[model samples]
Target: MSDFVTPVLLMQTLAAVREAGRIITEAWEKPRSIKYKGPIDLVTETDVAVETFLGKRLREILPEANVLGEEGSPAARPEGTTWIIDPVDGTTNFAHSIPQCGISLALWRNDTVEMGIVYLPAEDELFHAVRGEGAFLNGKEISVTDESDVEHALVATGFPYSIREDIDIVMQNLRAVLMTTQGVRRFGSAATDLAYTACGRFDAYYEIRLKPWDLAAGWLLVEEAGGKVTLYDGVTPFDFGKGILASNGKVHKAVAALITDTDD
Candidate 1:
């Protein structure tokens, strides 16, 4: 892909994402009326408000681009360029008063992600990456760690909402990795976990049954940061429905080996 992301466009997009995060943060600090979308799934007023705000701003800035958001998207996936958005990535955590949620946005040209932005309002951290350009966290260039030994690496992971029924498979994979890694953490936010991995805060990250909005932006950030991300089988992991595995390129192969089960 050509360098379609000019510096001005990048700055504008980052500003929009930051503003969206601020909206979420404001609602988070106040009393939020929450409801259930599914058995354990949730939907908050903040999520809808943030998504609406982002969709409007993005359309005004890039009218030619389509939008695919977690809260609401077009009936059919549009052709050419599209924006994937997750207004609040860690809704469960946010509902529980945990400050681990954030907003994730990605621009997809054809089938490839051209740019990504993830903003954490609570921490005032902004992570962004453009195709072929390096990743950054709050204006500082960032890269994955060079730690090659799995036993010496800190790992991060998340459980699928289907954990109620597929607990065995998820636990089995978790157990396998926990035994080999130096430490494991479940922060309940896939975007944040992947962003952290790209910045060397976490050596690796993995998760199952995530949507495109959950991984699209963060995936590009990790790859641009000199890291590697793929499916459990070591293939390119672009399908939003399947799952994802990401690492600092050092323990990627080792981690992939332990979670290669295909049977659901």
Candidate 2:
């Protein structure tokens, strides 16, 4: 564990996140004031409100750590301790009164994640992990699936917001994965996908063109749960740029081969 992470700090962080979760739940009950960032991309007032609250509270909790949120934040930050947050990971689902959305928060420093928490307030499921420790949902420990066969694995994925230009590639990879895996699911939330993978709910999860806030926390959760995370090539490290594929380690290479068509 990093010198920055302590039991008290972790508890403080979780309390702040749970408070943020209350904000999401409150906003979710009423109609959302939605705005489109792009043709299909969404940003709700709830998203902004939660991010704002998190920014304020987290700053108070860790005075040294800067906040990098999905909303109103720089695309990247310099080397330092930072809080990477997705106020609402599944805004579309939340807008539709679905229960799959959640708040994703991670303590990131010097290219490593010290801790991560993905809390679905609507469903009341909170998944968290600390480096060198293990993953947990609510309070129970969690781990990735042990399945090693691609044909029997249940996979999860999401398309990029810029899907219009990458439809060909998205569909191509989707088709290959669908044929290879026993089943495929798109929950419309990258954070949820990774959290589910960490808890063994999904054997693997992959996507392209994701921001740091979306993958930062879940990245550590997957690894802590004894899984593997990488780009489509299966060897390259993910710098929060694109092509993220996370699996149970047992079936990582096989799924990567399917997505990249390297098996052919």
Candidate 3:
């Protein structure tokens, strides 16, 4: 593989993400123009504006690369040197002026992630990770927690937009997780959930039916920070269209049990 991970490239990616994040915060300050992709899935004008702007910025950073952004790239797949972007990860939270939204960008190639970034404009936090190197938050190295006991671990999760159909399983897993862990939180933003897992604020996170842009950047973040990312099965490789169970390595199997095949 060619060298896509460099100080210069990471710097450029961060600048673009921070620049794009401004749109998220700016929109939160105004009345949102909303539309529904489904009964529960939301789209705001700012989501489109940020993705459009960020996609162009990323292409400039790697002119030969493909840009697959959630807002516009419905039919696009991960081609050579693809940059996957979620312009605003928590559109509902953003539309409601909630402060938990963020922007996620990842560079994927040859069936692997090369680099990833998740920027929370409201908190002014920029988290990043490269494939072999460890993860970072605001240029400082970071890692997942050392927590090993499920009874003391703080886990996070998000509901699917297809909640109505998935509710039975959702509640089953939710109930299992709640009974197994110290606490469970629903942040409405998978990027935030994964970022928190990476930085040790959360011991683990799990959610079903996430999109490519949702898991691309944050998956690398968790693993690079000394955590684990996988499907509920605990052995299968996780990808864009798969459900995820991400946790500090010590608690991965334990958490996986609760969210995966817990008996009712």
Find the candidate with the highest TM-score and give its number.
Answer: 2
In angstroms, how far off is 112's CA in candidate 2? Answer: 0.9
Give per-model TM-scores: 0.95, 0.96, 0.95
Error of 1 at 238 (Å): 3.8
How much is the lDDT of residue 99 in candidate 1? Answer: 80
Q: lDDT: which candidate is best?
A: 2
lDDT tens digits by residue: candidate 3, 1-264: 227688898888888888898888777678889999999898989999999999888889889889888989875458788999998999898887777888989899889999989998998999999998899999999999999998999999998888888888999889998988999999899999999999999999999888889878999999899998888877677766678989998988888787753222
Deviation (Å) of 232 in candidate 3: 0.4
Please provide, for model 1 over 1-264, each residue's C-alpha lDDT reduced to its tens digit, 9 standing for 90 to 100: 337888888888998998888887787768878998778888899989989999999998789998998889753333478888999999998887788789999998967889999898888899999999899999999999999999998999998777798788788889999999998999999999999999999999988888888888999999999999888876666465666889998898888877744343
Clashing pairs in 3: none
- Which residue window of length 10 is worst by lDDT in model 1? 73-82
**Cα lDDT for residue 199, model 2?**
95
Per-residue lDDT over 73-105 for candidate 2, one digit per residue giving the tens place of the 0 to 100 score: 865742588999899998899999889898999
Q: Which RMSD values do the candidates have, in order? A: 1.6, 2.0, 2.1
| lDDT against true structure, model 3 | 0.87
Decoy 2 TM-score against native:
0.96
